[model samples]
Target: MENALSTVSSTLLSFFNSQALIAAYDVEIFEAIGDGATSQEVFEHCNLPESTGHQLLVAMVAMGFVEYRGDIYTLKPDMAPCLLKNGTQYMGTLARHASKFLYPLWANSAQAIRTNSNQRKETFGDERKWFDILYSEPNDVADFHAFLSVLADPFVESFLKGFNFSPYKAFLDLGSGRAALPRAILAANPHLNVAVCDLPEAVDHMRQELMSSGHSDQVDVYIGDVISGDLPEITQDLVHMGWMLHDYSIKTQKCILANVFKALPSGATFIASETPLLDDETGPTFVALLSINMLISSDGGIESTTAQYLDRLCEAGFTNVRAVTLDGPRTLLIGEKP
Candidate 1:
């Protein structure tokens, strides 16, 4: 009982850990220490007062993000890839997204739970749809998608390697942020025609990313919305929506699925990737937390069990519905047009 209470004690103070990391990112302390700088050098680099800097450094050491040697502090080697600005797997964008957007919304989680709705008005004084407010500014749009792209990198690699794409002649990715999946598909299966369908606001940014990534000539871009039925004439034999279904209420998810079903060619395959709750709804801890986060921050979004997802697919007139587990963060719920 005492041990359980101690765990509770630690859990309650966990926000301090998050805030410290955010503070480090905000002050450029992690980047300064990436090169194994001493406390004084880090303070100088970040323009932090020495005493506060030293205190934060000590806290970081205790948190295992930094290692304090006799004279120098260093980012823990394993964390450097994710924490350092120049690292290939940098997730500072996610940190920034959390700090700027999610954290404040989560502050009103209790209110969200009581009301069973998003807290956008409470947190940001905006009652707009989640993406409308989120994508209001260009920089906010970039940060939101950039962090998602980083998060999707593993899913892309795993999907490309695990899922068979050779049977399909053309592929369309709906709401494809950063175009990472379609880009990977193009690289691995060059013969398959690829395209991405997204909102008009995202088309320009996605086109730029595709162009810069050397896929402009190969991948097509389409402006469409799955919810409102403003869909492009999809000639693609396979359509994939990665990690998208959980962004809205169950009713909206069904609407999105039905619209996509109407857009696809006969005998086309459709896949929706998601991180869902377990069958018993016990825990895949992050996903459970994500469901709560969605409650507070999204448009009535909630995570589902794999069974719930497959049921939704079936309800949308999909045939041959099944689930595919990948070696990454998402599970692909697959169905086909009759």
Candidate 2:
């Protein structure tokens, strides 16, 4: 009974943990205590009031994000990569994104559930679609893409290890935010042609990134919208889209799949990566909660099972549709055009 009660209590108070972490990132507490710092030194460095700053520090310590010994606080060694700004897996961008956008929008989750719709209008007073409002500001767009690239790092590493790219000569990534996968692909399979297609709003940033990385001549950038079926002429023998199918309703997902199918060459391959529910419809806790986040934030987006994804791919004129398990969080749904 005590263990059950503790679990319930922790679940109820999870937001406290989240907010405290976000607060730490907001005040640059983690960065301040990089090596180690006394409480007074941390408070002074962050310009935070001693009293409340101490309380926040205590919360972080209790949450296992920080260690307190000898009156000095230090970021947990294992957490440095995720907490520090310069670390490869830096999560400060995601923390800021959740604090500014997801936290506020989730306040209306109940109403969204009741209405079966997004609460963007209620939360932000903007009735426009999710991407429109999210990408409206340049900073917001940058933050969104930055955090996504951080999240995609693990998947990219796993993909490079587990997937075989030797069969394909040309590779195109649709809706490639940050072009992380494409760049990684180019590095791993230098013999193949790599390209990225994204919305017009995102193409400029991608071009600049490629130019700065000295990949401008190697990787091509094109403007396209999968939902509108406005793709460039399909020449790539292998195409991939990552973490994009779940951003819309079932109908829209089908539309995107069909559009991709129609655009690809007769013998081309297509793959999409997604975090899907289990066959039993049980929760993979994060994806389940993310489905709720989608309910409250997106336009009819929801989580689907692996079988459901394969069905959608088959419906979209894909043959030999199957799920490819990777050494990462996302599952890749592969299909061939015949």
Candidate 3:
């Protein structure tokens, strides 16, 4: 039994943590406090008023994101690498994306649930498809994809290390944001050919990025849309869609699976990586919350249970459909076209 007031206070005060972190990233305060700087030095570096700057730093300190001693403030040991703008593990892009996009959309979560539809119109006054509004501006596109790529880094490592890509000669990754997975696949299996399929809005930029990264000759790029049944010719024996299936409703997911099944050659392998609900429908808390976030922000997007995902794959005419576990956050739903 927890104290009711304590529980209520915890929920009520959660916004303070979010706002403090948002403010810290917005002003690039972590970048300003280089190698343990005093309050005055940080203020001067960030061009912030001393009084307001002091307040924000104190808030961050309370949030355990920074440490203050001897009148100097510094990022906590664990936070330094993950918070600073130029830090090796910087995740400010995710923080920025949350503040700029998700926060506003989540504000109407109740309304979204009541209506069972996205609140994009209410949040941004743009009723276009989620991706359309997301990619409407160049900066927004970069913000969305950049943060997702960063978030996918650990998953990419887990996937590359865990999955056996040796059996396939040609591989294609759908919705291959940043081409991280494809890059690693090519590196791990040099004999295999790798390509990426993405919407036209994303293909050119991803192609340029791959070229700049010196993978111009090794990786191919194709334009495709899985939802509308518009897909590139299938030459890949192993096709992967990473962390993408949960972004749509069950019907659309089935459509996507069917489209992939139709596009692949007989006996080709199809894999989709997703963070699914447990069989008991308990909580992997972040993924559960993300389902609600999807409900509020996307068009009929919601997370599914592993059983639910496997069922959809089977319904799509995939033979030998099954869920494979990796030592990572995402579970792989695999099937074969027979």
Candidate 4:
């Protein structure tokens, strides 16, 4: 009976902690309960119906999101990952961005299916100008990069640990924003010579951070559009494309991959670290959430699965392909030329 009860309880908690639960947490119902609020108080605080609020509270308590003692309810530590404000493991953004923007746009994915068009009209109307928007608007740039960095955190040590970077004469980080990803990797591989390829505005920010880190000489700046601008023909042993390939359409991804394929010397490696969509073309739910965000935030990008990426790499004539997950969805897709 105890074993059965535990199994039943686990199922209930999983259901309550789903994306819907995060939305409730976003509205602060869990914290209010922790402050010794009643069901009616929770309803008033969250602007939800009293009957509905009571039901949700009951579920939350059963799921260990809240503990009820008579009329008072308190939040549980296990549930804090979604409820805590700005907590390190806080997953509230999944609900905040997922529900507010991607959810609505995803509701129209059927329209895209019917018309064979991008479901988001507004995102596509600007001719992929969202890149420029993210680049120029400092706040948005910082926020999105922080979001990406958080996603990359769990996987950092895996790829960082796997490769030795000292052989490289120089490192070129393509589409490097704030350059934090490379920053951490550089710390791990101290002898690496580094130069970031990004716009002038972004390099100004990168310079200060790099200089302060005592890497003023190890790291330098190259201002150019990596796609169209003239690239340095240095033939470095390692070039990084962290979290970048999924941001382009397959055609563009192939083009970019082909360019990098040609640029690398023998035994050189190209690393693309990102959350895996799925092995099949159909994505895992977490990646589906991000893919929809890409539709809304980017003009022409969607999260492609490992199969799709491998296809692009093979098509571009890079013979070696490997995928390894560090944790959860955070993964590395490494390709080497034969």
**Which of the numbered candidates is closest to the native, going by highest lDDT?**
2
Supply candidate 1's per-residue lDDT for 93.
Answer: 80
lDDT of 2 at 235: 96
lDDT of 4: 0.66
On the 0 to 100 scale, the lDDT of residue 336 in model 3 is: 95
Residue lDDT tens for model 4, 164-223: 666666677876766776777778776777767766666666676678867767766777
Clashing pairs in 1: none
**Model 1: per-residue Cα lDDT over 24-88, one tens digit each:** 88898998887699998999999999999999999989989899888989889998988887786
Per-residue lDDT over 103-201 for candidate 3, one digit per residue giving the tens place of the 0 to 100 score: 899889899989999999998998898888777777666667777877787778888888888778999999997787899888888999999999887
Q: Could you tell me how far off, in angstroms, the CA of residue 252 lies in candidate 2 after the best superposition?
A: 0.3
lDDT (tens digit, per residue) of candidate 2 on 1-338: 99999999999888988998998999999989999999988988899999999999999899899999989899899999999999888989899889889999998988999999999999999999898888887777777888899899889999999899999999999999888899999999999999999987677677877888889999988999999999999899999999888889999999999999999999999999998998898889899999998889999999999999999999999999999988899999999999
Model 3 residue 291 distance off true place after TM-score fit, in angstroms: 0.8
Task: State each model's C-alpha RMSD to the native.
Answer: 1.3, 1.3, 1.4, 6.3
Where is model 1 more than 4 Å wrong at Cα? Answer: none
Candidate 4: which stretches are off by over 4 Å? Answer: 1-75, 78-82, 122-139, 166-170, 176-180, 198-224, 229-235, 262-267, 274-308, 317-331, 336-338
Model 1: ten consecutive residues of lowest lDDT: 134-143
Which ten residues in a row are the worst by lDDT in model 4? 119-128
Mind sharing the TM-score for model 4? Answer: 0.67
Residue pairs in clash, model 2 = none
